[model samples]
Target chain A: MDFLTVIQLLDSTVRLATPLLLACLAGLFSERAGIFDIGLEGKMLAAAFFSAAVAALTGSVWIGLLAGIGASVALSLLHGLASITFRGNQLISGVAINFLAAGLTVLIAQDWFSQGGRTPSLMGGARFEPITLPFADALADVPVVGPVYAELISGHSVLVYLAFLTVPVTWWVLFRTRFGLRLRAVGENPAAVDTAGVSVIGLRYAAVVICGVLCGIAGAYLSTALQAGFVKDMSAGRGFIALAALIFAKWRPWHALYATLLFGLFGALETRQDVITAVIGIKVQGQVLGALPYVMTVIILAGFVGKAIPPRAGGEPYVKER
Target chain B: MDVVPKWAEVILVPLISLMLAAILSALVILAIGEDPVAAVNLMITGALGSTYGWGYTLYYATNFLFTGLAVSVAFHAGLFNIGGEGQAMLGGLGVALACLLVPWPHWTIALLAATVAAGLFGAAWAAIPAFLQARRGSHIVITTIMFNFIAAAVLNYVLVNLMRPAGSMDPATARFPEAVHLPTLHDILGVVGIEFSKSAPANVTFLIAILACVLVWLLLWRTWLGYEIRSYGKSESAAKYAGISPFAITMIAMLISGGLAGMMAINNVMGEAERLVLNAVEGAGFIGIAVALMGRNHPFGVFLAAILFGFLYQGGAELALWTSIPRELIVVIQALIILFTGALDNMVRMPLERLFLMIRRGNA
Candidate 1:
């Protein structure tokens, strides 16, 4: 492929991968802290709808973003209440949250907007506008680096940069920070953390909340930036795909970025099937191409690619006495 | 002697949880500026009052019965097989193929052949995940979920490329021959001199679903294979000690689950739609998870749960048709029921256990 074509593919990969990256990071934090969250999809859906609804109403993307985060966090707290407080099955709680979000978003949206279960199309300040970096225009004429700098790196919604930046920040938090240490320890052995004078429930709840925040950003980015507004089931299977990506990355932040990017590339190819068909000179079914990420995930999980061992204490709700 | 009665454990807990969910759902309806009482009345009338409503409810319930049984069987083997959606999709393909490839003389012959094909197809889809989980140490939930999506893509490809009728704009297979079209409830009931809704989609597959439930009950409780599966589920190490292989149990359980899930296609593809259409599985596969949970992984419980969900679906459709309540609200209600009955069980159980303890202490 030519340089510009490659850059364009990379650009599309970035756009598609942003949501998966954010959700993957969200799952990373939650799962690394020993919580198995299958509800990332549901949380994102809730955030997307709330964000879009608020953005349409107030015509301010910021307020909508906040509302989205708040809505997602509320669901996270609900998960915490059931899984942590009530000692319920984490997976079941996650499934319930997903179902709740899926249904509630459309129900409330239709009740409020009456636009057939969708919010009004967002525009102007209500939607996220791409930011061009300072050197983007000036560097546009430069041969090899210009388009890569201007087209691939500079022009993206602000949330895209934030998502990419979160990988490093997550790495720092997970390794360098005391809270991260405690979080990891709690996941590996809650009893050790408890004996060392840290609260297991508190740390887990914190992890889940952080997860909710990241998922919120991802969801808001979808409705406000990726698309003009929220539609029912707009998150599609992205949350589940993010979960697959998380497993593919073996629940690490950096690996999550690569996995999501690879998956996003698959998705990008799916959207641009005609271009790919012309380039490859073959008949390629879009559905089969779309199925690549999921198929790859299965192959990876089956230990063909590499072993994926979850956190030692993941999925089990911690009991204080036990 | 156990403090908790078997009957109470089976029935009481779910009843209380369902009641709590209903109350909460009513509050949500009230919040939406609608009359919760009227909504409840409408739901009952719409789902149960008329033969027409009953027909749709039973039809939906038939689909749930298959998928719910699928989930329950896997659960009994300590596996969370979430790929029922995908399995059912493949089963639809099997049904389509069976009806299309051979010119059966009658619907009975077609149903028989289609059942085997659908079961084999669903089992084949699930077998991959089961194999991964059993031999390769993969998580069944994740693999099965991914398979669901893959199943959709495969079904789409087949429908578009292979099954679509010539010159047709729709991405669906040509309708099955008239001889292969299964008898609807109206046709069967009328033969027995009982009037039924002519347009209702409930058909002979509903009987098959009930029979499957009965067979599942016997298999789980009476058969040696079922015993082995349950023992393995209870403790893998213990089962190993008892000479039960985890691999065998997992495969058997998932195959049965997938087969049950696949059988749902007989109702949808052959009975209702009469064609293999894209996304015909819809969210029935996911709903199976909720049904399994609500049913407590019991065959009888699954039957009741399926009917309840079928009611919600048919009733919800009526609500959307007649009132301002959106169709998605039904999903919210279903989710709430799952939340309360499945996730928040301990919320109710802990308090109930304590109360029971207090009563027993007083008696002592």
Candidate 2:
């Protein structure tokens, strides 16, 4: 209700939306290349664990980011091997990867840390410190613009900025680049791309790898930047929520930013149930707010509000004609 | 005309996949600095060495049987119902309502009513997704996943606000009436002078689960609708050309799947806990996917896979209680099995097919 409260909510919204935006963009890349990845959650969880674990061990967040990306890329390659090379069911492969990540992360975490499937809480340089933007302190006294610039926009971890920045980069790469054209062609009609002398498998694999990198950054952001350390099931369905956001955005990059931000707002509202109850003049359950994103996704998917059509060749393995 | 023998297709492939999964699980155990042999020994003895363990195993297997059959029925119709967890949770709500609202004079009647209520609730929960998939071209997988979360939220609301007994802090329904308690395996076996574990939760629902398996086999293989479902699954365009209705098959298959998944609540909620609680289904709905995958979507295969998982579950619990191996090892194994058998089928099948062709050529 108050301006400060609204700013604070928006700040948390930006923080929460970072992972979703990253993962949504990740899904956009993979799905646009004809590979449906439901395992985004699993990949994020694995990256979250490894990033935190390595960060705790080596005390370097940069090295941890690399490890996180490496973990995600490894899983992505496995998915590629199953869905692309072997021509297996993409959804089943995604499901397997998800289960594998879910189990292995906790299993290994318990084995190493013995903290009941949690890594040691990160501190100092091992975590991503908040970077206050230039003039944030100086402009604090100015009215609406100053508070918005200083309190809401500034003081987020570096990943938050990167996540937002990647949106434009993704839009440029997807719409303007030759590789992007070929990737889109592969997802829409792999045969046309193949006939044009591009290797469908290679292009798709590239897209999948890119997806892995983005998802890895998202996971590292969760454990290292957002929270202090990895917790069991810490991704906590964020992957699926990201998938929903991807659908809600209709697999577009810029739209993904808005979709993720909206979902993030729902998350912020869930955390601020008291504020919601005050505004509504009646008790509103956090569970209802928590379920809002998923419900909205289903409505979008069912084409109630608008159609969210996926790539034409999405979830289908490409087999070259002899 | 098949390259591989029927026996090999049905038995050998899964056997080899199971072996691969076992080897990978063994390596995982070794990586954890634990002896795989001792762990296996402990699992075997803990799960099958005594009636107490068997009770727990059978109880778990019963839950899997319903959920696994749920997945299998949908798999036959080419519709994946991954919302089994949500459906089962709603099913628990159904069972709770049926048991709590009516003062049933007998457990038999209560069981019948609860089964119907559970199935209806599960089917109702699944209906929206099924409708969207059938009519609107929405992906069933995504829609079903969304439904699972919604179902969880709905169940949470119901338990916390509506069902929770006054003054009780826990978000769970009040206990069902004593008269509605189903007979446990101990009580049933005791009548025949056979010893069984009294503390174990395995109950008459196990028999019901067995019966459901038989009924599902009959429905899929012996009925006209099953033929239509299989045909539709094999080739939708061909089925349509042959006059089979795609919408009808999808709707029917999903309803059956959701109903079967919902029936799992009878075993867990009514027979075991006798109270509806948050996360009552736990992860059994997801486990159903693994079971159905390993079982190759066959009723008989589902029965065996359910028992195997049941063993793993009970054994894992014992392992967690006895050692540092943590219970999540079973989940890893389950993942490996799904990977090998479902996703990476060609990884095994291609080599096996080549070997079979070579053997046949040599024989010629």
Candidate 3:
């Protein structure tokens, strides 16, 4: 492809990667504090449904985004309560939340909207709009660099930028902030953190809540930014993909961005396999090519990966001996 | 014995959760301007009344039993295996291929080969996670969940590309030749002139599932291997001290569990549909977790829990026909059941047994 085309792909690649990156970071924060947080998918699904519904109803994308976040966080908190406080099975609880969200969303969508999923299409104001900064517009007139600035870096939803920005912010909070240290300490060794005069329960709860908030933004971005509105199972295993990104990134915030972007690249490749096949002159069913990302991901995770050490008591419930 | 009421702990939480979920579901219906009472009542009448619905529900319950057994076995070993879906898919593929492609002189032999193939594939799929967990200390939960997605995606790819038959939105294989479909009990129902009006899929698979349940119970309670598994599950460190290899036992337990799931696929494919099909067993494998949990990891309990889910599966949709709501509400209820069963551990049988023993001794 020409420079302009390559630049275009680069910009779109980042935009596509943002949702997965946001989600992976969301998972990273919670899991780093030693919670499995399996409900990320459910949270996303819930947010997607709510955001779509509210966006279409009130005709305000911003309000819809807030509503979506609220819905996801509520479900996330429900999962947190069951998994963290009740010390329930993290995997099962997460799966349950997902199931509930899936069923409830569909049921409600059908009830109110009367569509077999595929929420009513959004209008101009009800949808998240891409913004090209004034500088981006000016830079678009330059030669090769113009195409790069115009196509790749500009005219994307604002969330895309915010998602990238969160990486540095996350690193700061997780490594430098006291709350981050306490959260990390709880995951590594609740006993020591407890002895250090921090209430491990309180710290972990805060961490989980933070996870819910990030998951909310990720979900809102999914419905409003990534796609126009929610469709049934629109999350389409992205939550699990984000989990994969978490492991791939080793739960580091900055690394998560790269890991998620890599997955997104694979995703883009899979989607653009038609273009790939045209260029290469190969023949294969589109579905097989599409399945490549998941297959390759599993292979990478299962085979070459060295080891993933979960937080010392990540899935265990803390029962104070005293 | 301590004065704690027997069966209270074993039963209360699940019962409460079931009632609460049902009530909440009813409220949802009410909010949606639907009559919950009439809808549920129609579902009950339809499921239990006609022979066909009864048969379909029983067939589904059998699926639940196998999947639930698979999950429960791992749970008893202190392993949470979310790979039942993948394992079951592999098992379904195995049975379908065996029944559809294998050349067998006799139908009975063909069925046997298909069932074995299904069981073997299921075991193999499960063995991947088991082996990883045993050898590398990998987290089975995440690995299994990840594989579940891969399995579905791969299965879809294979079915649509390689195995799809002509003129079908459903990516299913050629129907298994007549030799494979299990004989329905409706034949007997007719012989006695006690017509099972509307015919059901009541066949020998139910008997096989029960037999498997009995065998699982025997193995769990009466065998040295079972003892080792239980001990290992209760405390891996202690199990190691007692000379059992956690890796070996875990692999064996998970394989067996997965094999049982495979057996469920046999009933679903060879015994019923008689073809390798996409969505053949549906999400029964995943639903099995709820079944196994509700049964509190007991053979008999699983049987009943499977029936409950079976009823929901049949009724959840049937109610939809009579109401505007889709039958998938059953899945919602199923999700609620799984959530409650997982969160409240005391409903499980073994712990209840221990609590009972403690209570009895304290009273004495």
lDDT of 1 by residue, B1-364 (tens): 7666677778888999989988988888888899988988898999999999999999999999999999999989888888999999999999999999999999898999999999999999999999999999898888998999899989888888988999998999988899998899999999999999999999999999999999999999999999998989889999999999899999999999999999999999899999889979888988998899899999999999999999999999999999999888878878888899888989988877887889989999
lDDT of 1: 0.92
DockQ-derived CAPRI band for the predicted complex in model 2: high
lDDT of 1 by residue, A145-181 (tens): 9999999999999999999999999999999999999
lDDT of 3 by residue, A1-322 (tens): 4565556556667876887888888888888787887788888888888988899999998899889889877877777777777777777888888888888888888888988856898878888899987688788889877877777877888888889999999999999998888888888888898788889778777777777778778888888877888788888778888887787776788878887887776666665665566667986565554455555555555656655566777877777785
Pairs with backbone N, CA or C atoms under 3 Å apart (clashes), candidate 1: none
Candidate 3 A-chain TM-score: 0.93
Docking class of 3: medium
Query: Order of candidates by DockQ, top first?
Result: 2, 1, 3
What is the C-alpha DockQ of each candidate? 0.86, 0.86, 0.54
Here the TM-score of candidate 2's chain B is 0.99
Alpha-carbon RMSD of each model: 1.2, 0.9, 3.1
Candidate 2 segments whose C-alpha is farther than 4 A from its true place: none
Residue range B124-154, candidate 2, lDDT tens digits: 9889999999999999999999999999999
Q: How well does each candidate superpose onto the true structure, as a TM-score?
A: 0.98, 0.99, 0.93
Better of 1 and 3 by TM-score: 1
- Which candidate has the highest TM-score of all? 2
Residue B79 lDDT (model 1): 89
